[model samples]
Target chain A: MSYRAKVPKPTVKRLSLYLRELEHRVEQKQPTISSRQLGDALGLTDAQVRKDLAYFGQFGHPGIGYDVTNLVDRLRKILGTDRTWNTALIGAGNLGRALMAYGGWQQRGFDIVAVFDQNPDLVGQWLENHRIRPMSDLAMLVKERDIRLAMIAVPADRAQEVADRLIAAGVRGILNFAPRRLDVHQAVSISSVDLALSLEQLAFQVSLGLLGSLDEDDD
Target chain B: MSYRAKVPKPTVKRLSLYLRELEHRVEQKQPTISSRQLGDALGLTDAQVRKDLAYFGQFGHPGIGYDVTNLVDRLRKILGTDRTWNTALIGAGNLGRALMAYGGWQQRGFDIVAVFDQNPDLVGQWLENHRIRPMSDLAMLVKERDIRLAMIAVPADRAQEVADRLIAAGVRGILNFAPRRLDVHQAVSISSVDLALSLEQLAFQVSLGLLGSLDEDDD
Candidate 1:
């Protein structure tokens, strides 16, 4: 059974960060963590931490906090990183190439096994262990490599078409970096990493005049 | 004064997408948009849309809908896009260098005017209009260019120290690609965008089985 089916979108996102932090705590020989403790570590509120964890069947105690090792394992299982997944990068652009080289993706349970590009210059090159391929071979690659997840880092204009092709090739999940929202079939779950939105999040905080000057750096 | 400080995190994210759609509606000369119509366009519920928007300020009418032009303006102001921003980038790795070359950042109101790196190999290289500089010159760059925002695409281990230096130098907002939490004083907004989180989100979706074999070409 998919553990995520029962969880909300916000809960799922927070679980990834929480899992990482829990692993760190476990390594530090911390035996238990309270909701407030975890929240503090992440700059979140105690209630928010408890509410997010509650979605996955109450892993925390009333007062003693949560067992570090157990929470990590439970969250890992819920996030489906208990198994390995083969991820394909559809564009060999700078962002896609950087992602292939990031190294954290592998540690987090993903392999960028193949890369694609339409340009002759890029297609002939090798990225890490994977070789870049011409776009003509995408379908063959999807079948041969059994890649179920595709990351679309192509330009905005081609993002939708590239996504359509990835879906056509049987990929079920897509993480899009294009500025535009992509249209996909009901079965495809696309999550866009809008760089603007990330920056805008900061801009909103700046507008608050919270630390308009240098006082925020004192702590 | 910030309409976003009152809205939920998820609501703010959805508003970005909503504003994009609202702009299109305005261009098409649509009279107004009802909560139901807005929800349908984005595959959400009418009540849910109402709830999300209500957190900011009431822009939708009781019986009719929202004024596209007015709503767009409200969203822009809430998002803090009333003026453009100049951004600096630290650690001109492949990711940073790629971002400098990409035109998307410019369109999003952030100008990539400066780059910093400790690697002497890239110190003299030109990225678009800006030359990569040695780390020693970071503080001066922040002041001379009036750089309020920065993008840190450095390695995870170096992220905190680099961010600390940036914060110390008076950077108000940061978009970090580092996979760790940053401890900073209040008023300074720091957001870390982990590449693996998006993949994990997809994995969670797959494990949950909310999406079936989604592909346009799937038989």
Candidate 2:
């Protein structure tokens, strides 16, 4: 499952979806699953599922389909979910706390090891299990804990500043919940979960009288 | 800009992006913008931008490009952000509170008119200005307030339950934050914002050393 060719971003995302589906099947004690079954569950076509999985390698037998356990392991390894990633959370506000409280991240191998905030009042407080650290401690904690990923949940005006700090602190990737576009160096990878964007999409469907027909799976 | 033809989902999402870019240009008091400039700012191509905008309707002259204000207004109308949409929030937990605190929704036309929770303790509490109501009152609020959209921020186990209630209460569109697949009838449009999916996408890039090169905008 090593990366030999450039996989399309969409294919990579579908791989994550397939992994989730496969995990569910494994939980049900299913021995193997065909591409058709997987597609039906996720509202995708079987050929599309096969095409996405092919980006990694030949997965399962042609007629018998994919062994649930083996495919799960392969997809997990390909997705890098096989190993735990230590992450840092910046901005201990409501959004940040909600993200921290989300249990899926831990289940999928992302651990929020450190929490940081600029407010003096929140700096000494404990959120969940982690003590809120000051902004000055970011670089040090990133180095000491070897945190390569960070989540930004700051205000729009402060998103770029926190991103700059995270980048300078040696974070390679960031998942931003802030509603502002962040300008970053080429080395830093950023993904934003824009709640407004999703709502606007829903609004478009509602306006067009297409709300009932459109199927969406992404949050 | 009425729905004459079915717009592709990807185009609809990009329309939102175009509106955001145009709003930024308007704030700067810029009078006009070409497709190339808009595309560059959002990591899209000039032709792609033109194609997306074309789905709604023609804008600007061929040689002069689009007027900033005209394009913004057209996009806003096409995306249904021209008027406010009344919304309801279910589940008054940390995530629900965080969503209530988010200012972008109201800024971009989605208004949270009512908040509901099943827990008796949270039922009487106030989140922001809206007094939290019990689940029993959802139907009444939906009808009285004309709330066409609902946001579900409950725990994963409770997400489906709340979604059913919202649908039963006559909510036409839903934005679910709970990290699980929701089964709903065809008449209800639902979109999920899976934080785990976004993190896994980032993880895939970090693992493959492609984090720096992959450019992603939502579909």
lDDT of each: 0.76, 0.81
Q: What tens digits encode model 1's per-residue C-alpha lDDT throughout B1-219?
A: 744345544554466558778988999999899999988877668887888787767668878899888888887786667777878899788788667766766666777778999889999998778788988898998899898998898988898898889988888888888776666765476666777777787777776665632111110
Angstrom error of the Cα, residue A67, model 2: value is 4.4
Interface quality of candidate 2 as DockQ: 0.47
Off by over 4 Å in 2: A1-5, A28-36, A59-68, A212-219, B1-5, B26-37, B59-69, B212-215
lDDT of 2 at A166: 90
Per-model TM-score versus the true fold: 0.86, 0.89
Q: How high is the lDDT of residue A132 in model 2?
A: 100
Q: Model 1: runs farther than 4 Å from truth?
A: A2-5, A30-55, A58-67, A210-219, B2-7, B43-56, B212-219
**Given candidate 1, what's the lDDT at residue A132?**
89
Indicate the docking level reached by candidate 1.
acceptable
Which prediction has the highest DockQ against the true structure? 2
The candidate that wins on lDDT is: 2
